[model samples]
Target: MLDTAQYRMAEGDTLPALLERYASAAKATEEAVAALPDLDVGVPLPRTPWSPPEPEVWSARRVLLHLIRETAQHAGHADLVRETLDGANTTAQR
Candidate 1:
């Protein structure tokens, strides 16, 4: 099996390559979650040493909430970046 150190990429990778890797990882995550049997969102998550410093732990529902919040944050930032690069803006119209 590959060692954990092999996971780190060398400095030569391009932006597009990194973005593709990110997309693939996200897709795999979604597929894994979709495969799980339905359960209550409020079910308590298993405790792990990697728990966040603030909450210390989270319910299964909170995990989804965090994912939604993070995805929205990144998408909003991407919109701003795209607007800066091209003249196009995705602002809402009345």
Candidate 2:
């Protein structure tokens, strides 16, 4: 297994690349959350088909829009968790 120190990237890799990795790892969860109607803040997205088990994950239209929405959710959840644990809230309004 790779050690923690060795897992660190060298120079030239942007920070968002690291964040994107985390987002990618949580892909399924993000997609699931994104499919929820309330998750679409002011955006009237198409109604995604019910993601049934055994094969049908989600429709193509839902899949295409998932990445952006997923990443945003990751960022939001991270912020809240970090702030609460740190004993201080973020100044930036969500």
Residue-wise C-alpha lDDT for candidate 1, range 1-94, written one tens digit per residue: 3245434676797889988998998898688568657533344444445544544444555767787899999899999999989978867877
Which whole-number lDDT from 0 to 100 does residue 56 have in model 1?
45
lDDT: worst 10-residue window of model 2: 39-48
| Per-residue accuracy of model 2 over 1-94 as CA lDDT, tens digit each | 3245534686887889987976786787567666766533343333334433344344445654776687689899999999888978757777
TM-score of each: 0.55, 0.34
User: What would the TM-score be for candidate 1 when compared with the true structure?
Assistant: 0.55
Model 2's alpha-carbon lDDT is 0.63
The global C-alpha lDDT for each of the candidates, from Candidate 1 onward, is 0.70, 0.63
